[model samples]
Target chain A: MDRLIEAIAATQNPSVVGLDPTEALVPAQVVASFADEIADEVEDAADRPAAQLAVAYFEYNRAIIDAIADIVPAVKPQIAMYEALGPAGVDAYTMTCEYAQSHGLYVIGDIKRGDIGSTAAAYAGHLGGVAFGAGESGPYDPWHEDAVTVNPYLGTDGITPFVEAATAADKDIFALVRTSNPSSSEIQELELAGGCRVYEHVADLVERWGQGTVGQHRYSRVGAVVGATHPEEGRALRARMPHTFFLVPGYGAQGGTARDVAGMFDDAGSGAIVNSSRGIIGAWRKTGAYSETMSAESALDLVADAARNAAIAMRDDLRAVMP
Target chain B: MDRLIEAIAATQNPSVVGLDPTEALVPAQVVASFADEIADEVEDAADRPAAQLAVAYFEYNRAIIDAIADIVPAVKPQIAMYEALGPAGVDAYTMTCEYAQSHGLYVIGDIKRGDIGSTAAAYAGHLGGVAFGAGESGPYDPWHEDAVTVNPYLGTDGITPFVEAATAADKDIFALVRTSNPSSSEIQELELAGGCRVYEHVADLVERWGQGTVGQHRYSRVGAVVGATHPEEGRALRARMPHTFFLVPGYGAQGGTARDVAGMFDDAGSGAIVNSSRGIIGAWRKTGAYSETMSAESALDLVADAARNAAIAMRDDLRAVMP
Candidate 1:
């Protein structure tokens, strides 16, 4: 959490780009360009389409990372988009994480993974890289994530392992406290017998989960994911969980505005970092300059430029609301 | 759900083998045997250890699948075990699923994935294979799973996509209701203002989520994951979620007994299927026949024989308690 806060301070930006690439987000020409190469390289014809799209996703993510690495403090790669492509897509996801980290940007992996105690220990490997055997020099960290989002439905034991791993690796984890989705209310907003919502209880638990692991930045390694969609709730939660930093999502394309997320930050405007996935990464779609007739390189150039501009706009939007 | 029910009836065994292989579970010689082969195959020296273990896991799973295919109706491969090894491990997970399906056994992928609407749709591609492009012959079904487990924390929108995908693919899904872990009660057992527990509310949602997708077996495409550790709750839930099926975990190694899970079944003995992971897959360790000097082939043979014996013993144990 301290590292993320410092990176945000260095960039003077409280926004992070979401590198959630899909076939629609990547340029068609780029995917087409890889077809011949993929055909020759891949032995199975059935695996070609997914393999080609996976490569295109990596290229698209790289372009965006290169374009916004300096302006943004972090990049959140949604694992669902990659997992949709299967094992090959998973390869692209790891590659994207490695690329983002190499560019001096904090990589917040939006993998909301949760399970039982032992299994959660296994999933915590995203933070503590796999020590395959007795090992060589050290563990091979295939998924180079600085922080990852976790689901809190399974309770304390499920999250404790992640907290231990994050503490050990000097990384951070954001538990899903209040999500940005509409149906989130169905479960998260349910009233408990104690006159508090489920999400509120979860917020308290998240704060407790981060107790011993608070960094010098006055925040905990266990952050809370408070979506930008609920402004009033975000403001209320800001007062409730003092030690838990927030990873605010659902901005831009998801209809979350700067005013909505304004109170999510602290008095110093450092308690939360807003994220815009489709808003930033798919900015080229909104740009009228993108043409189907353009070559792969030109299309990618457009994607990079549009993403940079969009990321800057988001930063400024959040800054205007900041104290 | 109909497919699973019929398969369970075919073997007269309401038990599923859980293929969750960990470093401690696999025989030393089996992993050691893959060292030289992986060294020659994997270009990155750092990746050899994990890659080697990944191959050994697939081989180990293949042996277990072969031994138990005739006796067990299904195999639930916990994805977290493979994910611990990174992308190489994920490959093994898919390969394991494909092999089990080829053996005429239902493959229940124990991936408790849930997200927001759009992201859930992307994750639903686990059931609905990725349609990479227009010209693709058919979607490359990379994840060869007949059914998958989903987390219901995100509520309705997070679950709809999986239900739709499972319906379209003629597959099924089991949503986590009351998990098997000790700390699961922290959230699941919280008393609501409406005089019911949080898990009961989720149970109703699971029942409703599967409404329109009911099959010939009087069960819906959606199933509930009720742990074998809670018999009273399981029995009550069986009565509550009538149309919903059950995929019970924590049967053997997780301190659950056949007597504890007996009530989870319906009067006809068809509502629930119990799972045992370590008690079956890692059974070779308890067998005194296993020696460190044994060959990889001999170790796998031991693993297979021990697994078959344990699985058969488990089936008989469960049958003695069944209706």
Candidate 2:
């Protein structure tokens, strides 16, 4: 988180472009480019669709990484999109994260994984590089991301292994506190016995989990995912968890504007990194201005350029409020 | 859940063997069997360990599935174990699940995955055969399982997608209510304003989520993961969510005795399916009685036999109290 914060500070931008390259968002050209390759690898007609899409998603992610690597502080790839493509999809995910980090952007694999006992330890090992054998940090040693998202339903037991492992690796975890969804209020907003909401209770724990890992930026390695859609709650949680960083999702396509997320950051503009997935990567789809004379390869270059411009615009939008 | 219960009835046992094949629990013979094959695939030495272990875990799981297919109704392969091995690990998981189902055992992928909106729907599509497309049920159909575990922290939005998709696919879900870990009480057992525990609140919601999906067994497709370690709470949750089936974990090796899990079931002993992982699959490691006359191949066979017998012993033990 300190490294992440430092990156944000260095770029003077609290934006992490989300790399959720779904089939619909992936350009038609990108899918076509991989069609022959996927068909060659998989003979079955049925298997080719998932394989082709999987390749397209990875190629699209790599393009997006190339587009905004110099501008954004980080990239958050939601694991579900890649997991849907099966093993090959996961391999793409591994490659995408590797690509993003190599481009000097922090990678947050939004896995949202949690469990109990050794199972939790396994997730920690997978995401944070803490193994349990003679090959303590096994063959996937450097493959672990710098940070990952975790669900906190099973309480401290579900979260402690991640924290311990992250602390050991100098990595970080962002617990789902106030998520950016319509029905988030269904359970998260329910008032507790002490009159605080359930999310507030989780917020308290998020702060506690980072007690041992405060970094140079005055932010704990532990962080919270406060939705940009909820400004008042974000403001309240910001005050509550002073040392914790924030990974504020729900920006752009999710109906959250820069003004909506302004309250999530500290006065110095370093406590949070806002995310926008379709808003940036799929920006090419929104604009029907590509010239007919443009080649497929050149069109893809244009798409990456659009993403780069969109990221820059987002950075400026956020800077307007946060800076 | 009705189909799951019916399968259990056919076997006269409510036991689901957990196939969490961590390296420590996987036999040395199994690991060695894959060594040559893994070496053949990768000349690079650094890649050998994970690839070897990944194959070993899958082979171990295939053997276990074959061992106990007829005795047990279902097998829950915790995805984290395979995920720790990277993409190949996930491929092994997909294969293990497919193997279990092919052998006529219900496969409950204990991949505790959850997220907001389309991401959650992707998980449902991967774990169950429902998707967010024109096919909604497409060519990538046979890949899904009978049921999967879900984390309910993100509330209705995160779970609703799974519920909708599972209902469409005629599959089921088991939401984490009270985990068996020692620190589970830190949040799940927290008292709400109405004097109901957080798990109790989740129980009420689980019942509500399953309201439209009651099947022939008078159980909802949406189930609850009530830890066998929590007898009193399980008893309370049982009465509260009468329609909800329970997938009880933490039996045997986790200190959950037959008596401890008895309360999770109804009078007919059909409302819950108890799981035991290490206590069964790794049972051979507990006993060093294999003679020198037994070759490595025969030793692996013995290990499978031990798992089959252990599963049977667990079923008999549960029946003693349940019946």
Candidate 3:
């Protein structure tokens, strides 16, 4: 938690770019380059497209990471996007994590994994530690993140192992609280006994879970994923979880503006890090920054620059609204 | 849901072995055979143990699947154990799912994945469907599964995509309701304003989510993961969600006995399936079935028979109490 806060302080931007790549976003030239590389695999002709696209996805992530590593404090790679492509896609995710970290960016694995006790322990091991022998822990995984997002539906039993592992390794986790989706109100906004929403109850638990491990910044290793889209809930949760850092998703393309997310932070503007995926990576498509007269190759060459500028613009927008 | 129930009837067993392999469970002889296979990987000396164990873990899972494929209706491969090994581990997971289904066994991916809308759709695609260009759907992943376990923390938005995809593909989902872990009570058992537990609230949403897609057996494709350890809650939930199938975990090793899990089933003992991992795969260690006089190779050779017998014993135990 301290390391993440320090990174945000050093960068003067509590913003993390989300690396949720899709085939539609990958450059045509990059996909064509990897075509032959996937031809020799022992799969049917039908399976070759996803295999080739997986390699291209990694190359595309590398380009984005290299472009934005200096500006953003972190990069959150959503695991589902990579897992959709199969094992090779997982390989791409691993490589992307390694590349981003090598470029001095903290990585938050957006893998919302939750399970029962023993299985949760295994997941904790996958995130930060690996159990080699009884009562003996091996070294932490290099490919695993400094932090990871987790689902809290199975309750504290599902989350305890992760909390223990992160405390031991000085890593961290962000538990899903009030999410950014439209139908999230189906369960999250439900009225509890005293008019407290379900998300409030979850936030209370997250705050209590972090009480044992408060960091120097008055925050704890246990954080909350309070969607930036819900500014009212964000304000309430921020006050409720004074010591919990927030990983605020739902910015830009998800309809969360900088002003809407401002409430996620403390008065010092230091407690939350906002995430934007398509808004930055797909900025060229939305902004039409590249001229229509440019060839596809020329537009592809300028994408990295456009993404870098989009990230800078986001940082400025956030800074303007935050205290 | 109908397919699962029919398979259980055909096999006369509502139990599924969980392929949650860990390094300690893999016999030493199995690890030795795979040491050479991992020798060329670009890993440090510290990583070799896990890499070798990953291959051995796959070998161990294959043996277990082969042992019980004829007796059990299905097998649930918990993704965490395989994910602990990195990309290679995911490869082993994919192979295990494929192998189990090819042996005429239904495979349930115990991946408690949940996220916001767009990301959740990607996960749904990973489970059973994939979106290609406009109006086109790619080939379903054979390495995927007949069903998957999902965490419901992000509310209805996170779960809707999975339900839609599963219904369209004739697959199903098990939403985490009352999990088997001890600390699950921390949040799931919390009493809401109307005196319903948080998990009950989630169950209500899960039931409503599948309203448009009930199967032929008078049950919805959406299911609930009710822990066997909580018999009282299980009974209550069964009465409340009569049309929802149940996937009960926490048998044997988690201290959930056959009688305790009986409430999860219908009067005909047909609506639920139980999962046991270490209790089945590590039976040799518990029962002392492999003679101490045998060589490591001989003991490894006998593991499959031990596992087969253990699975049969579990099935019989459950049948004795179910009806």
Candidate 4:
């Protein structure tokens, strides 16, 4: 929604929480409470256990959505975690996407899928809407998502399908420009013939691809994912692709402080969404907020509070600099 | 399995068929035959549609395996097509791998997955079996396959996890050195420092990765996927990665003929497997042998015959060139 841009501008906050929901990381009460309901229906389908697991995942995402709906402007779901569960996992992903959309929260699917030619089109089709040939209805319509992350290793052809589909769906795409991982330097840092690093070339290409999809907010639907860990590079990338939104990861648990991400924001606190996944979900566990006897719900409340406080701090930091 | 390799060497054939069972391409009889069984079972659980679909996929793969077991030494299954269906899709994939193994065929999973660090380990953990975590029987295990395909964009960190797991399982890996897609050159052909192209660097890395994993057949378990279209490059990469096996694609429907891929074979035909997916599975549709007058078994027989004939021709050509 265009209001997403306006929401960022209005609150001066560019923080987006990631709803990863790893089974091992979830609170014990949340697991204990949902286990019975899941067990009753899943007992018959023991062979396909992922279906039952998906139900719990969806519930967990819904709880997170409910808790942070007022604090954050969007939620980014990591597709790999859901995909590892199988189709039932996809079902949960789709449902969570719909739930997030209904709550006026923008959904960004962190699916780094890449392919070439018609296969790329198929992936884009599946992401955008229900594809005709790849079994029943497509999982999670692209229109429902405000944006999706894509891998750029296959180059323009790999990204074109997503560009075309996203343009048609009135959504956005965030290409992997610089990832937060320590090993990202391996290929991304390789010098090309022209002397620019691979990631820089990708950044330039992203800017070009975004040119055709400019929205009413003066930003294009194409965005770049520049890790906040590389603050200087992030600023350079932001300067290079001024019209493109930046989905900056590596915040919080990834060792990026809020102050480190300040350069990604525009003068009005626009064009960026800083993401924090583990730092938010596992905050209570790390802070010892829950006692051995405390309920999971109480611990979750503290976890949600920690996330809210973190977002507020980030928002305040950006405002102090940009205001 | 080593003896099997010796047999293939003696025969001078490196042609392997890929079983990519897309639903749209299935024969009408097979679809109609399985329709009632699927419908009846789908009544109880709507979420288990993939399970029913997987049954059809498993049957189709079984039929294809039965048809080509005598013609080829190995089979590659594109995991994406199966995964597009969901967990039942995964079920179909695992079942097909087991079936191919039973038929004395090496199974290569064409899942071009790559990630960084622990995430890469998670992927390898799923593909290559993991031992029990502490006291648990391990979170999930597929018992590992004979081999799996990987992407090298994330560099050595991405490959290290795979190497570790595959080494532990005594399995193999085929890294994406160069793909067959027309636009692959966009990133893959970029010139790096020291006058070497990106693909050459990747081939060099593959060579290094294979250093510790050489099998008794004079070829390493680590392999590189060199497109058959690039004959000169294929020969050069083969020379560069002396011990690494070359998994050549772009044969048949991709337009590189049997002659174009001959350079990939070692002196003894010890290190390459050319793949043909649509050329085999969709042969009946292409040759107009699946007309209304033709029986399902007869049409299937024709499809298998074409595949066997193609393989034989390829085999004869390779044998003719050997010293």
Candidate 5:
């Protein structure tokens, strides 16, 4: 959290680009460019298309990362988008995270993974890394992610392993508190007999989960994901969980404006980072600069430029609403 | 649900083997056996260990699947275990699922994935498969799963896509209701203001989510995961979510006995499929027949034999408790 805070301060931007790629989000020509090479490399004809698309996704993400590296402090690569393509897509996800990190940007893997104690420990390997060959030589990090989003439905034991892994690796974990989607209210807004809503209880647990691991910035290794759409709740949560940072999503394409997320920040303007996925990555689609006849290189160039512009606009949008 | 129910009836075993492999669970000699081949295949020395382990996990799972194919109706490969090793492990997970399905066993991927509407649709691709090149000739099924486990914290929208995918693909999804872990009580057992517990509300949701998708077995595509650890509560839920099939985890290694899970079954013994992970897959280690000096092939033979015997024992144990 300290590292992310400082990176935000250095960039003077509190936004993370969501590197969530889809077939529609990525340029079609770029996917086409790899068909021949993939068809040659991949044995099965059924697999070649996904393999090609996976390669195209990496290229698309790489272009965006390079475009916004200096402006954005972090990038959130949603794993579901990659996992949609199976193993090949998963490779692109790790490659995207590694590429983002190599460019001095923090990578927040939006996996939303949760299970019981022992299983959570395995998932925590995203932070704890892996040791193969004998124990003496190495614990190679396959997923170069700084923080990952976790689901807290299984409670404390499910989260403890991630907290431990984050603490050990000087990384962080953000538990999903209140998501931005329409049906999020179904469970998160349920009022408990204790009077607090379920998400509020989760907010308190998230604060406690980060207790002993507060960094120099006064935020802990555990963070909370408070959707930008819930301004009042996000504002209240900002006060309720003082030690926890917030990863605010649902801005831009999801229809959350700067004013909606403004209250999620602290008085010092440092407690939260807003994420805009399709908004930034898919900016080229809205720019009207894309042409179907364009070469793969030219389309990527357009994607990169459009993303950089969108990221800068978002930065200014947040700055205008900052305390 | 019909496929799974029929498979269970055919084998007379309402049990799914959990193919969750860890370094300790896998025979060391088996992993060591892949060292030379992986060293030649993988360029980086740091990656050799996980790559080797990933290959070993596939082989280990193949043996278990082969040995238990005749006795067990399904296999639930917990994705987190494969995820611990990164992309290579993801490949193994898909491979394991593919192999198990090829062997005439229903493959239940214990992914527990959940997200917002669009994102959840992407995760649903685990059941729906992916269309790469032109969407014309191939919606290639990369993940050969008959069903997948999902988390229910995000409510209806997060679940609807999986339900839709399952309905379209003739597959199924089991949402987490009352998890097996001790800490699951924190949120799940919270008494809501509505007189029922939070999990009960979720149980109702699970039942309703499957309304229009009922199968020939009198169950629906959307199922519930009620832990074997909670007998009385699970018994209550068995009555609660009648149309929702149950994927009951925590059977053996988690202190859940056949007697404990007996109440989770329907009157006809058709509603639930229990899972055993380390209890069966790691049974080879507990067998006095295992030795550090045994060859990798011999260790795998022992693993196959132990897994088959364990599967038979579990079947008999559960049968003894059935109505």
Candidate 6:
């Protein structure tokens, strides 16, 4: 994994694609490709709606993974999308994580889970590997994602469990310091005493939390999710916590260009993984690059090309400023 | 459901038992009773650790539900306990909800889910129901639950989607105005401008959001979750939002007694559901009623008696004070 980071650095690209498969946003060809197969399965298993959705989700994720694995250092799968489908959704999530891992891409489970005390511990256990009862068989092995996203609204008690579990599992956590959504300012930008903003306080906590999990790559195993849309804030947070990795969302479809995200990285592109979700997986459908006659495989090829191109473009933009 | 409220008023008891099945708290006898069966299942299905744990969880919930269903007006299943087991956990959760419903008890799905905008709508869809292709299946059938808990951090946008969904489905939502956890005061009690606390602001929002869903029982479908530990605050909130239902937690094991929770109810014993999870479910085990030779059925009987006694005692306590 350390070697993979160095490899990514060598390419001078810190772009990580997000696989947020919204049912409505899937390419027409992709939907058409699976329509008949899904119909057959649905007919056969009328009692299992969640299972049918899970199968579709897995196929969609596999397509995106195959498309973007070569260009992206990691693939962030939004757990909410999978969870929305229910247990089968979780099954799809696990399968997608496994698929991404097999393709040599880091899997960041975008689960913005927050709770107090022991409940948080349970969530961490679910994300990282839970010890099997000595000898257990089955494909539902505990997931060991490279990293996970967490919310810190409940303060220290909420985060401690995740930190403990991630440490034991040799994984990482990206705490929400500032989010990309417009409404995020309502809470994150609250003015505190002595002229410090709430997010600044959060940034300091991120630094403190990362102290124990410092990695050899000049970043900590504990990371902060600082949105690319807030470039000035992102730069300040980057400077505030020099040793912490940054998971920067709000790129592409969220109105953040590569140039806006450049300040989030270290001098050597060592500290950030910029995420673009809707921009990548739903790119073909958005851009209309594939016609109706195109095969789903061909459409996926174009989608992958768009994602790879986006990553390359981001890399070039960053290098133009940094170099 | 309205008639149920009327029955509670007639019975003069506002107590609702919460079925939070924490594994560690299960009695030794009950644990031993299921051990062999669970062990065999674990041996057969080693791959699905979640499924194995979920089987135990479902059995435990069934035991608890069967024990207390006759006495309690409702059973609040903490979604986190079920979620900890993964998809199988969700299956267990659905089964538990159905079981509770079948016993003529309301099932409050204690899932503190909150998101913004379209994502919020997606959560509502997932929780309520989604529009699948005609005659085709969708995730979580529309009529699965009577009510669900929601977090209110994102303000109006976060809650409106839930309100719309609940209105359409003829369901209800208990938004987190104040939580029972000790750490809840950290953020929830923050002093805002204009002489109103953050929670008051939340209460006001709850009042506004719930305006449309007022049932014949004179309570709105949207409710506030006010901790029984904060009696004065709960009373104030109740006064401010007269038509809103109040779901009071932090009773019993969390340290707030029946007297402390009494203020959350209206004069007629309406608009409140006081929850005692561990106090009800784990009562017999803690009270040493489960001896060495006590069978699972006997232990369950003891549990039922304890819960029924507690509810009766609570009713007496409330009745003694009411004019």
Give lDDT: candidate 3, residue B284.
78
Comparing 1 and 5 by DockQ, which wins?
5
Candidate 3: how many backbone clashes?
A: 1
Supply DockQ values for each candidate: 0.73, 0.58, 0.55, 0.32, 0.74, 0.32
Q: What is the per-residue lDDT of model 3 for residues B1-323, given as tens digits with 9 covering 90 to 100?
A: 88888899889999999898887777677777766767787466666776777778777888888888889999998989987877767888898898888898988999888888778888887565775411234554735699998888777878888998897788899998988888888778877888898889888988887798787887898999999899989998988887889999999999899989888888877789999988889887866665656665666667788899989999889889977
Per residue, candidate 6 scores C-alpha lDDT tens digits across A1-323 of 25336646654567777777777665566666665666676553543555555676677778777766776678888876766665566668878888998998878888776665656766776554455332533223355377788776556777788888777766788888887767667656766544566677778877887786776777776788888889999988888888788888888888898778878877775678788877767666656577878877786677676766665666566567552
Provide TM-scores for the models: 0.99, 0.96, 0.95, 0.86, 0.98, 0.86
- What are the per-residue Cα lDDT tens digits for candidate 6 across B1-323? 26447546554566677766655655446655655666666554554455666666667778777766666677788766666665566778878888888887777887767654556676675455555522433335522567887866555776787788777766788888877777667556655544556677778878888896788999888888998889889888878998889988888777896677777777776778788777777776666666768886676677666766666666566566543
Flag the better candidate by lDDT, 2 or 4.
Answer: 2
Question: Which window of ten consecutive residues has the lowest lDDT sum in model 1 chain B?
Answer: B129-138
Interface RMSD measured for model 4: 4.5
Candidate 5 residue-wise lDDT, B123-159, digit = tens: 9999965445435553567888999999998889999
Docking class of 3: medium
- For A132-200, candidate 5 gives per-residue lDDT tens digits of 543554356899899999999999999999999888788999999999999999999999998999999
State the displacement of the C-alpha of residue B172, model 5, in Å, after optimal TM-score superposition.
Answer: 0.2
**lDDT of candidate 5?**
0.92
After superposition, which runs of candidate 6 have C-alpha atoms over 4 Å from their true positions? A1-12, A28-50, A129-141, A193-195, A218-221, A242-244, A266-268, A287-306, A314-323, B1-12, B27-49, B133-143, B192-197, B291-323
Model 2 chain B: weakest 10-residue lDDT segment is B130-139
* Residue pairs with clashing backbones, model 1: none
Better of 3 and 5 by DockQ: 5
User: What is the per-residue lDDT of model 3 for residues A155-232, given as tens digits with 9 covering 90 to 100?
Assistant: 787888899989887889999898898878877777777778888888998998888899999999999999988998
Q: What are the clashing pairs of model 2?
A: none
- Please report the TM-score between candidate 1 and the true structure: 0.99
lDDT of 2 at A176: 93
The candidate that achieves the highest DockQ relative to the unseen native structure: 5
Which of candidates 1 and 3 reaches a greater lDDT? 1
lDDT of candidate 4 over B1-323, digit per residue (tens): 24336545544566677877776666656645655677777553443445555676777788788877876778888776665554456668878888988888878877767765655665675453443221244334342257788877777887888888777766788888888888788778889876888888888888888887777887776788888888888988878888888888888878887677777777765677788887777766767556766665665567666666666766666566543
Candidate 2 lDDT over residue span B246-267, tens digit each: 9999999989999999888898
Ranking of predictions according to lDDT: 1, 5, 2, 3, 4, 6
Q: Write the per-residue lDDT of candidate 1 for residues A77-180, one digit (tens) a residue.
A: 99999999889999999999999999999999999999999999999988855556435555567788999999999999999999988988889999999999
